[model samples]
Target: MLLPYAKPPPGDADHALLPPRSVPARSRTGEGFYMVRLLKSALVLFIGLHALFYALQNIANIDAAHGALAYVLSGADHAAYPATMFFKTGNPLLAWAALAVVLAGELAVAFFGIKGGWDLFAARSGTAEEFHAAKRSGVIAAGLALLVWFGFFMSFGAAFFQMWQTPLGTGSMEGAFMYAMASAITMLFVSATDD
Candidate 1:
């Protein structure tokens, strides 16, 4: 039914019933599909490197990070609302634990992103099924990115710890939102099925 006008060119009944073999599946799909695979790889790699460098920076400035967490948890300048924080703490152990969780999450995202990006890049010239299979790691990275930024920073830090009260906290929340949006968009773009 695909090529009703085209005949099997002086062939037997079995051959005549089959679709034309001249046109390839690749020709029907075009090159844009391959370009999308490449874009997915590049975007994931960018997010991976961004997270990796941020983790490194956090390690380099451990004292600063710890201090920031301490200040946020202490609820120092939360004058906007009269409601008191239910879980305010100045313990170094708690702050350190929080920082560790963040670092671990970032490192995990970096690992998955880099690995997935490389897999996708390597499968660019492969069949569509191969490229689809290569997206597993990238999808995981994107999900972790959402968990880190939206779940940890925005929901936990901002809502629970009241991190949006201070100027520094507001800046951090905004940055987290931006990163979350980027990862969400990338996830959607990379997950779309192509024919």
Candidate 2:
């Protein structure tokens, strides 16, 4: 029932929704907004720098890196596991191929992470949409990090090569795990909506 003096409801009011003229709450615009964006960028930058340095190190010490890869691939000192696993090889060509893959992956991660961080930093003062859009590179970098550390090192090196049996391999696996987790955490953090 409607009062005689009451006005009629909106013709398009088929559902209980906010009025078209209503203003949304100020969630994205705040003092903490820039800080959040900066933090995300900084985290990604750190990851990028880490990869860059690692790649540089490997390149600078190519002989050592090659030897390490050879040691792990050959499964030479794995006394406990008498049975040999597949892909175990002492071929220099294979060692070089593995190293090349690692270097390439690391460089890719570095490139994307650095670019993403820069993009996010540049868009810090812009609209929320812009900042969100800047996260694409960061996301790609995180994926590369996972592919390199988790997929290549952990799965192929540690498991397939039985690298865990050797001291050097154990050290390498630990480092790889750390890098993987760092990238994952950064990705999750960066993906979060800024409010």
Each prediction's RMSD over C-alphas, in Å, is 4.6, 6.8
Instruction: Please write out the lDDT profile of model 2 over residues 109-142, one tens digit for every residue.
Output: 9999999889888887777677789899988999
Candidate achieving the largest lDDT: 2
lDDT string for model 1 (37-153, tens) is 778899988778878988999999999998988888887788885376477888989999999999999999999999989988988776778878999999999999999999999
Best by TM-score: 1
Candidate 1: deviation at residue 145, Å?
Answer: 0.5
Quote model 2's TM-score.
Answer: 0.84
In candidate 2, what residue range of length 10 has the lowest lDDT sum? 19-28
lDDT of 2: 0.87
For candidate 1, what is the TM-score? Answer: 0.85
